[model samples]
Target: MGQHEKVATSLADAVGEEIGASLAPVDAELERLYPGDPGTRQPVHTVYVPGDAFAADTVRSWGDRALDALDAHAPDAASFAAVLGLADDLAEPVYARVRAKLEREPVEDLRVDFEDGYGPRPDDEEDQAAARAARLLAEASARGTAPPYSGIRMKCMEAPVRARGIRTLDVFLTGLLASGGLPDGLVLTLPKVTYAEQVTAMARLLEAFERTHGLRPGRLGFEIQIETSQAILAADGTATVARMIQAAEGRATGLHYGTFDYSACLGVSAAHQASDHPAADHAKAVMQVAAAGTGVRVCDGSTNVLPVGPAAQVHAAWRLHYGLTRRALARAYYQGWDMHPGHLPTRYAAVFAFYREGFAQASARLARYANRAGGDVMDEPATAKALSGYLLRGLDCGALDTGEVARLTGLTRADLESFAVPRRGDLTASSG
Candidate 1:
């Protein structure tokens, strides 16, 4: 034996057991609170249409309009690339995919907005609209014409509209029940959440709906619209978004930043009110940080700029929207709200270009990591996890073909996930 190697301390095995026992509750709590990302497909953009205007063909119409916009303005990869400053290497592939995406799955997520976009309707009028929304969405889903995710954004839980909001949601869900069943991709949004209590109320309402319908508990989850400053920070100066997640009782699926509303709430002038505004960034940063490891994604808000008018004007608007979408993606906010049909071209263009631009490097690094082969850029398990997620997201959004990803990395989707996700035991197991 080596000198000094045989030396022993006065430590006992019971001491180790004691520490483990003391941490048992905390381990359980952490696991319960942060189960990690669900590893499901997250849409890249959520398109909002006024509730009263949503129809069975709305999704298809949006796709056609986006294609038309591209045909009229861009006409080809070279022209589209000029608009967005897409690199020459990325132009053709991204342009082709953007068109294909618009044709196949134009709207990844669609929200029927009853909150601000559709405002101040009579009780009977709103009631009928809610039911009609459900009917239309159900019909679209049945006919395989609906977006992957479809839902409504109801009024907030404020005192003036709490009952009305509840009634609207009740009518919508009940209407879906009458029209066969809830769509598999159903999503609901509760807008203007300023308090954790409001999240709790929404959770309780969903629970009652489940009980009444004999649906599974937690079957429904909603996105929390972060439109007010109070929702980001509480009166006590703590992160209210974190508390809202806790109060949601595990039913919050996402936190969507309301660009204009949030900016206005912070007193940002209308001209300066944008998603990239410092005020908006702060709110979304708080939201993103709070949602980390909690399986709730944070979505960036949309730009009000519409790509319309003459060729030059449309090109300029496309530049802004494309730049904004690309900026949000780089910031790790993978999803955003798309406000217009014309926005779709740039939205997909940016997304496709983003992933396509990085495809080679990401693939090579993932391959190296998968093979445990040394590379210039050293990667740890955490970095590997991020790389896997990036590729997966790119694949999910039609930016990267599944076969291409597998060929480049020599890994299947399941194989990537094996490295991407961390199990509970991996978090606390003793390292030798």
Candidate 2:
């Protein structure tokens, strides 16, 4: 028989219970408000087409134009590599994938712009355009010609355009629902949101739409366009962006940066008004932190330096776009906006190169971790999560194929998902 030793701990079980009871509501609130990332296929980039200019073959046309730009400027892998400083080994593979991706799936996400792109228009004219966008998008969906995710960006909910924006949104959604119901990839964007209350209004509007259409609750979610300084910081000096996410009440899907508008809001000169600017980084950092673990993704803003003019000018623009895209990816910002077709090649080039460059090493490390085979790099569960997520994103964007990733890591799609996205039960257990 073992003799009992004197207990050194002073606290009783009741004390622990008291603390737990006090913080029970905090636990519930955390679960309700901060749902983790929604494990979904996020697009690598979003391409915006003006409302009136969008057509049935818009996605295909954009791809063709991008391919043409590649053909005209960087006809060979060597030339493209020279322009982007891509290593020699990656040149052939990345180039091939970028070209094939352009031919196969060029535009991952397309937003039909009804706001700034369409400009002010007659009521009837705007109504017709909205209806036409719905019809064309529905037709494209049926024909398998549409991008993976497609939607409209209505005008902001500001006083000057509130009625117009609501009407346009109603027309579009109604038209879509009438034609074989909304597609699974349906998305919406509300631009230039300045106040948290504006976000609440959008949520309420969507809820009303759902009730009117006899759809389920919380069916429509949107990306809040973070362009105004007021949205970033309120007069009271709080992080209004965080408040905005709370205001969505589980309906906010993303926070999209607006490069030009945000830069102008801060009074930055046009020359320095780019996605990688210091001001831009500050804004996006706040956005990123605010959105973390809220299931709200963040999208970087676009660049205005279009790849036009002569060959030299096109090359310069391509380099800029490529560098920006790659930089954003490294910073954990997976998505950005592509305003012009010429930006497509470099966009894909940078993305493809990034994934391809680290493929071998990442695959090996992940394999070792999975097998519990120790290696030079000590891996943690969190590291495994990141590694799996990296591979999955590469797979989603067509940079790495399923067979290849599976062959390398010996993990199936489901296996990778298990590591990348933890279950709620698992999270709760770990938290305790």
Candidate 3:
């Protein structure tokens, strides 16, 4: 028995050293790039308009028009409320809140699209459009009508259009910078990136723009469109998103999904290209995983169900758009593309309802977990983090004010403000 006990053991105990020391640099990198909380404000939806159609008051005008259309189409907030599955009594109040938000901050983000929205144009016409867009952007900034997040989307840098895309972007940026420099929250959108080299090239171009405009090194970040199958899945089935990010060299601020293009690449017909399609989900999931912890925001694609035509048609379209937007919100993809002015109201409505409906239960669950009440309910750390995030999102999107969030969550303004980064031991405690 003594001899058996004295037998050699292959297991070894960990030495007295810092296990995370070697990972210090890696952790620092991940934190620097994608901190537990990215303090940037993400809009509910980004309204995309043709480049030539952009104007200083586009967002405000769109909001006003959307409100009128909503009023006329629904005849009462309750009419649309029925569509949203909200209570009849709550409809007017919700509608008022959404209307106010739209008026005050009608567009949180705007993409002056030059790709699909603008389509092909003569070289001269394109340049003129770019210049006009630049002038309007400056006017919007001066008039304080520019959305918090505003930028332009250039054509894809692919063959037969690479030179044209770069020219349009250059012309636009040159004119924009001439007015001063990149406006606050400005970001360019690069479409159809099939390889990492495309992102690297765009980064270099952005760096040049910064230098030429006498702006900061990272002032000109861009959002890449994950449209083509090649962008989401390589020939060998390896994800191309991480490679794209690495190539961007920290200039990739966002990744936007393009439903139709991605679906077309998957051989899906026009009828099948939809925001909630499995193919779109697969592309966005790849985007989420690759861009996670990298500070690159992921945006869901737009719904093609535009609210137009007769009243019944508009209602039908609104219902579809509302459903798609809600689906995106439930997936934690807050930002999306809004194709028309009518989508503005529905966008805000869905976001507000999402918060309002979940507020009470989320707050109670969070408080209960924090207080260790253990009322047969439990939440993981990720759940707690997400709960806080929902509130933060509400506050950022103007759905909830500081006072409201404080009262609802029983957290101070400061605590709610730093909800992005929570204390490890106490989930309610913020580490701002």
Candidate 4:
């Protein structure tokens, strides 16, 4: 067999074995309880760093500086709003001192670390943490401010090991959920996922949590971090990811490309060069393809290097480049993560750019239809015909706003109503 075929066979076998070993009888109770998407609905962009990277002092300093910089540069209500939200959480007073210096700072996505292993927690500790996180969330929610997006990166099983014990992993995840559930669309990022069973195990825990908390079933969602040699070698990696999504039913929301782990697995130099190496690209493609049309988002991993200088220009440029790359990915139907607060601009830049481009293209197309001939002022049939094509194309490409379509087409609000109405008959007939 060809190399690709060989790889496919191996992955299929591995996944099959995992599923066979772990698959429980279908839970009709669970399925009926959670019938639709039950978790955070917003698109996720996580910011991750090792917890050990900062001491208590550094965190305080950084938090302070971030708040100060945000106050000055945000310049608008929404921007200022996000800045103010971080005021209490900035790492240090120095961060606050320099906060005024940073402009257009990014909002924190999800924070990640492996400070604790995945295992069960004492009920008391779990309750305390849950209460704390809940209080913070309530305060933020009441202020109409977004909470800091957070997540935990648990320890990965070392290689040469047959499999990581599921019970150990379960305890860890249980503590997180029981600790007052994840804060507003919390993401549990699993590293080094090599088989579908790993995804299933996680999903099952979420199911159990939903039962215990009286939360809607499937409310516990997670993003899988693909970073293993065996995972990359799978020809059907994309399909595997898709299957995982199906298994989750609706809790799964995003897939992230884990560059460092995958690189180490392949014996590639785990350096700056590895971020976008060919293998990494291949793995990203697998994730993208699998996530396509599933409504589950995908994100490219971070650039390990950090930029320097106070001008924020260097940082801005890095962000812009990163945003552009992410925009390209988004255009292909994927979004990426910004690992640091500094990368926030890049994240927003990419999202806004995509929306702007999509809007512009959609407008241009609709304008063509608005000017088409058929009647005194405009041709209803001709215009409708023209618009039908534009509207479908726009929606397909993630240009989700229909109001913009109405504005550009000059179609009466009523005529545009049919924009969302599914088309019947041939494209030409439907338009007429």
TM-score of each: 0.96, 0.95, 0.89, 0.58
The best candidate by lDDT is 2
Predicted model with the maximum TM-score: 1
Tens digits of per-residue lDDT, candidate 3, 124-175, equal: 9999998888878877887777888888899877888888888988998888
1-432, model 4: which lDDT tens digit per residue? 656643334366788877866654443433443232222224435655553342323323344544443444553434432432323222232232223222322333444344232233544553344344334433443443432455555544444321332333354445555444445645566667777776776787668767866777766677777777555455653456656666665667677777677777778875534556787777777777666545566777666554335535534544544544544454453445554454443344344434444455545555555465333333344444435533543333333345666676665544543542323322336434
What is the clash count for each candidate, in the order shown? 0, 0, 0, 22
What RMSD does each model have against the real structure? 2.3, 2.8, 5.5, 14.0
Worst 10 residues of 2 by lDDT: 423-432
For candidate 1, give the lDDT of residue 380: 69
What order do candidates take by lDDT, descending? 2, 1, 3, 4
Residue 213 lDDT, candidate 3, scale 0-100: 70
Candidate 1 regions with alpha-carbon error over 4 angstroms: 1-10, 424-432
Q: Which prediction has more favorable lDDT, 1 or 2? A: 2
**What value of lDDT does candidate 4 attain over all alpha carbons?**
0.50
RMSD of candidate 3 to the truth, in angstroms, is 5.5
Tens-digit per-residue lDDT, 1-432, candidate 2: 699887788889999999999999988998888888888999999999999899888888989999999899999999999999999999998899989999999999999999998899999999999999999989888888778999999999999999999999999999999887898889999999999999999999999999998998998999999998998999999999999999999999999999999999999998899999999999999999999888999999999999998999999999999999999999999999999999999989999988889988999999999999999998776677789889999999989999999899999999999988876555455422
Model 4 TM-score relative to the real fold: 0.58
